[model samples]
Target: MTETARDRLIVGLDLPTIADAEKIVSTLGNDVSFYKIGYQLVFAGGLEFARDLAKSGKNVFLDMKLLDIDNTVAKGVENIAKMGMSMLTLHAYPKAMKAAVEAAKGSDLCLLGVTVLTSMDEQDVIDAGYEYDPHTLVLRRAEQARAAGMGGIVCSAEESAAVRKIIGPDMALVTPGIRPAGADKGDQKRVMTPSEALKAGSSHLVVARPIVAAAEPLAAARAILAEMNGALAR
Candidate 1:
């Protein structure tokens, strides 16, 4: 039950520029196996930088969280897959989620449906005009994503175990809002320590600030990896 690179960390490239992202990635080196390209990077460099990174033998987690009409999302997903991404993010809407999943089918890519953003809280859910509690809404949307044939979900580690119990083992759980033990919470509202996240059954952990902004990026990554190893040992 040792932790593998595929099962563990996904470093978030939340930098403002491609150069900054590359700087961080170069600093961290191979301590991290996967990197997440969120809206910021996609907006900054379009998809070419992503393609270059993927071609360089790094796993790219494209966290665009695509939410559009089924046809549009399907086409977008197809294009994204063509760029050789390992995973892509989509909202848990049935049509878009299904389209995304269908696009990833028979390809080496995985479509990850976002349940509720880790930056959001209960008030954020209410503000969005959702009547359900944030946790309940996350669970409900996760179920919807699964029913729509998505490969997995993007949720907080807090809800991961419950979702796993509902969705079973075949579906992967990619939990963002992960901080290493004793790290600052920053803007994320629903955060968990790395070990807690893995113990909650997260198939992958998305970490940003703590690793990217650390004084020693590689040491920080290794600290996170050590935590994951402890969880796997348990």
Candidate 2:
């Protein structure tokens, strides 16, 4: 099925408390249909909130980025699948991806392999003891994710085009660090505009601070959705 701008935009609920997250969701209303619950919100009773959002027909991307021993990772994925999570992320380690895939079988969960973070640059990767640069490593992880039967990839839009070639047309290519034109880049080093990210082959864009922290959260979300619509029109 074809996607709408609303479907492609995954707002990151990166708030410190459940009240803040709930307030944003209520404010955004039906204009925003998809949400990403990351570490910050997840710690503050976001899992139950995530399940609640799912019950209300909102798509939830549970961004846990799980990485652990094969048994541990598989066990977690098994439960996340039952939680009705639309999507879940795990570090793009071959073993973890493989285990997650096996655990998520028979469910609709899309297990995403998180590649190098957008906040990390070549220096940061090297500092972490990686030989390859950021781009190369992202593609390598994409390949590994595909080989392990992962349903999608989580990568910076900067590498979406190259990664798309590796994962092909069906797999989901979810990108973060999406800064709208003229917006603050903040700590994101590989940020791209929403239109640019979508045109670059990103299937979904995860936005947080721009909308969640905006003075008018709904307006900020509408503006982004407009931009995404414009891109999809082309």
> Candidate 2 has which clashing residue pairs, if any?
none
lDDT of 1 by residue, 8-59 (tens): 6899999899998989889988777789998888889847888998999999
Candidate 2, residues 65-170: lDDT per residue as tens digits? 9999999999999999999899999999999999999999999999999999999999999999999999999999999999999999999999999999999999
- Give the clash total for candidate 1: 0
Q: What are the TM-scores, per candidate, against the unseen true structure?
A: 0.96, 0.99
Positional deviation of residue 96's Cα in model 1 after best superposition, in angstroms: 0.9
Candidate 1 backbone collisions, by pair: none
Worst 10 residues of 1 by lDDT: 1-10
